[model samples]
Target: MMFSSKKRQRGTLNREQKKRRLFLFTVILAIAILFGDYHSTIASSVGKETLTMITSPDYPPYEFYETKDGERKIVGFDIDIANYIKKELGFKLKIAQSDFNGLIPALQANRADFVMAGMTPTPQRRENVDFSIIYYEAQDTIVASKSSNLTKPEDLSGKIVGVQLGTIQEQNAKQIAEKVPNIKLKQLNKVPEIVQEIKAGRIDAAIVEDTVALGFVKANPDLQFNVIPSIENASGSAIAFPKGSQLVKPFNDVLQKMKNNGELERLSKKWFSANLTEEPLSTNSPPAASKGLNLDFRRIIPDIPFILKGIPLTLSFTLSSVFLGLFWGTALSFFKISGIKPLGWFANVYTSIFRGTPLLLQLSLVYFATPQLTGYDISAFQAGVFTFTLNSGAYMSETIRGGIQAVDKGQFEAAMSMGVSYPMMMWDIILPQALKNILPALVNETIGLLKDSSLVATIGVVEILRSAQIVGANKYIYFEPLLFAGLIYYVLVMGLSFAASALERKLRRSD
Candidate 1:
């Protein structure tokens, strides 16, 4: 009886041990799978060459986002061509996005391996970047309100004609302006923005590529486009690459092959033949038909969720920048007041340099130059944070210096008399008082950072403003969405102000 009881106990213990081992094995397998998946998602595969392609996706039928079943996918003719080339060259392709004006700068900065945004190869552009063989030739069109009846370049005399900045169309408009009398030109950043100006009656007409204009015209029944007569040296789009890139020849070879195999024609027909004018006019109508600052906020109702999603990113960026800037600024303030000559001189020079230059220029330099200077491809968000931190630190250093100096010298002497070390005294006693004195200034700086956060949009950080821009581009209306974004900003700033004021009162209680 005793032996049987012992045998039973031994069997139970063995079963428990096996269960424990199985549990641990399962956990280990799960962790391994998660780590492997994350690594593969973020980094290129080993021994597989990956090329980064940059483009402006607002150009439909070339590259644009289509939301289906709560997922956004970039689809169009250019994407098809890129996929074909990637397969032919046996290289993995990753697409990066930026504003149209920033694409060339991105290539110069080595931020992309190639550009395929239906870009033209002009003489000025050839000086900076190499080009593949022309794949598509597009005609210029004069797009205007249907009632305007403005049909030709000659009709643009004394009229405010809108064109996208840094495009072949803008250059074409300039040439026309020189020959046509009193042709006032207004350059915007995107084709949709130019179209908006026409709808709002702020501009008489806009010059856009025909394929792009067709998409807009179909969506908006109130608009019409007239094809401009093709002149010598007409613009044609080709792939753009960094100067002397070896991939240019391979890309051109694949393009030639596609042409020979009828693949190019197949893709062109697939994208171009599809009617994009399916958007219901009643639902997506613009404010043009109404008089005197008309707005239909209902049009952006569906996109509200998309635009609101940017708030978290904007807030995170601002808070991160402010915290990092505060730390750096405090350090710089110490250096400025250290009584060490070299440290003081270095701090002074740094402050002067940052304060003298424009913030936008600094942002551009950091975002575009960091990759070339250090082989690390700094993302748009990182570049924005780093640049804002550095720039804010310079200004805050001066503020902090004043605050530290304004602290009663007797407090420091008293601490020293109590045998407190200088660093400890500053950290525990001096900084507390100095911070109180500069709290208002710091709040002002925070507010400024919040507003300046919009600048990151230029470098492709899709914060609040960029989200609004994307919605505007998709809907083909400017003022309504932009005004809505302004309302959001105003509300945010007000809320921040209220919170800061409450904190100020709470801090005053300690006094």
Candidate 2:
């Protein structure tokens, strides 16, 4: 009986042990499954999180690109609002900066998550983008040189009207000009440029947003222009989103919260001196009677081949200019450091003029006006490269000079003591290390030149931005083609940055 009881006890113990092991195994498997699912979902979501946004930093009071300590940072009322909405909606913000006209096309290609450049919710813009609540109110006003006779928008007729390309003010200015006849449109890139152009007498008058015009006049007391009490048009600016966005509700919800919390009012007062937040205009307008989002994207697709043909020319222009800039900049740097008073002074003056003047003006002089002055008819492509190279060289000379100066004086002395000539000492010992130190700056400058290369489009160089504009004009769908152009630029810049970082890392490792 005792043996039978012992066997029963052992059997019970074995059964309990088996049950405990099975439970532990099941728990481990469930945990593994849960972890795998979570990780996979995260990976998948990351892959799907491709959101794009387009903006131009040149529009102040709304958007501005700023550089601090050599790092590019975009800031403005529009940027702040966009960032807030992006955070609220739990989406990534990929910002692409460009001329104002490029914003709409950027949206059409699913490249821009939204455009938050304080763009007015125009009937025309409504045809392409889905707009959120109107964020601010602006009245159109005309600004001219303080000395100009322009008193009204009517006075702008038959005279140069400098307006930013994509603003409702531009359209209003055009409409008003139609009444007077033969008004010339001199579209400029940004507010600052518009003011500068008017100040420089490049344009007779500039039709601009009232707030912007006010700011300009206040800043420049000497450059006076009377505001035309005749308001061309009044409109509310809003955040633009791509059509059928799931993020729209979340964005609007957060925008409302911000408004109620007085955040919007605070920002408004901070930027524009008044609270302008109001319920967004109705976006639910039955998708326009026009085909697919009121934009015919297909019309432009046919030009993709021709546009692609320009890529090689663009690359050639970039590479050639960069090469010439580096070579000429190095020579200029040597001349500056040579201590030869006349040569150094000449180099200094050259650098100063190129640095102070706008690249666009330099390009114009090179391509359009230089022929008259120098009696040489330069091709637009050649002139663009020439101007860019010279401008880049001037900027790079300063960078190179700084890098060389940063190198220890002892290195140069050591090479001199070793019986090396001045040129040999610079090339063999100093330049190698100086170039290494300045390599990152050079790469960054290259990226800048790449972006600025779009300026060449103005001279009819059929580059990416110009190509997109052509496409936009043909299709009347402004956002998609511009979006594609911005994407191309962003990808190119990112790739260049990656390469620079990788090279830097490799160089550091070698050190």
Candidate 3:
């Protein structure tokens, strides 16, 4: 009886201990989760909603497109960090691509929440946007032909040094020029272009970042890069947001956590090990430019479908722009002859400004300045279509006005003699004749707009030119893919021409 009592007491004690251990484990887990949350976003949830980020994906290891197993994804150090932060903050992340020059503009237009393109935060940039704490440090390099022996900043004296437009390196080159004599800066749009210029001897040297320069030199043994000595304010890449954004504090918090937990170091190791070519979309031999631009279409066969995907987008943009331009142009033509001083003056001034300024300039202003000036988040597509429409309207309005005036005055008199209203007379008698007269010119305008659609690539529209650029950047080759894209544009234009000719015949038959 004593043994039985002792055994029962021991059993009850064991059960109590088990329950206590389980309760303790739960408490510990809860605390750990709370601690993680606190570290992740400063204990506040900036969670939910998808955030869009803009980056110049041409810069690899930082952010570039990877094609694997027939699937394409944007993969790089920045993308990984972004994903981790999104997971921590409980938000979905969408990445958008743009030219390096367009990255800040995209942010200004609210086309993206932030930019992470290995971009250094310079004073000029800080004036327009806010930046998070520095995440990675990179040095500028002077890349030149091994034979040119341009290793130092002083060596670039009396040389045409190339730098990418709108880059911190451009600012660096200017500073160097102030110190070095006779340094003529030649600004280009891409590093690849700068490399070609160096090879062609058009430019003696280029100011490129060390990480990017490393990959270029490796791909082309003919070139070498020497790191420029660190500058006074040796700043590094930080996440950039629109000026006065609410996301500034939260992004900074997440970045701080990444720094403390060594996440940033881990990413730096993964990406900084090699340059862009380490993640080539094609495994074939590199382009044989040394052999006088030896063309290789086989290397891009795997990427043909990718480039073809741009067709639909191109068509949509072109059609939308052309139709909108037609409508707007017709309105402006009416205003030109409306005899209302205010409307005429407004339309005339509008035409003069759009006509006087370059289309590219107008597009940039509409895209970058719209958000700040209007507080509306204008998208890349919207900006492209709107700019094209306005430009086409400026040109088409004059054509339309000429077509309208050329109509026989007797027709207006005849319509009025029939007791027709002014609106009815203009709509029925004047417009039909004017449209017929301008049909060929209208077709020409359509063709012009179709070609001009390539400009949208500057602002990150994944149309023909941008897709070709992506493939070329991935393959470390330029000419073949661009030729193919040009061929596609040619075929499209030819098809459009055939269709227009057939439509003209049909309209003549109807008459």
Top TM-score hit = 1
Candidate 1 residues 375-438, lDDT tens each? 8899999999999999999999999999999999999899999999999999999999899999
Candidates 1 and 3 compared by lDDT, better number? 1
Q: Per-residue lDDT for 453 in model 2?
A: 89
Best of the candidates, lDDT? 1
RMSD of 3: 8.9
Worst 10 residues of 1 by lDDT: 276-285
What's the TM-score of each model vs. the native?
0.84, 0.47, 0.82
Backbone clashes, each candidate: 0, 12, 0
lDDT of 1: 0.85
| Runs in model 1 lying further than 4 Å from the true structure | 1-48, 67-73, 219-222, 276-289
Locate the minimum summed-lDDT window of 10 residues in model 3. Answer: 280-289
Q: TM-score: which is higher, 1 or 2?
A: 1
- What is residue 308's positional error in candidate 1, in angstroms? 2.4
User: What TM-score does model 2 achieve against the real structure?
Assistant: 0.47
For each candidate in turn, give its C-alpha RMSD to the true structure in angstroms. Answer: 6.1, 19.1, 8.9
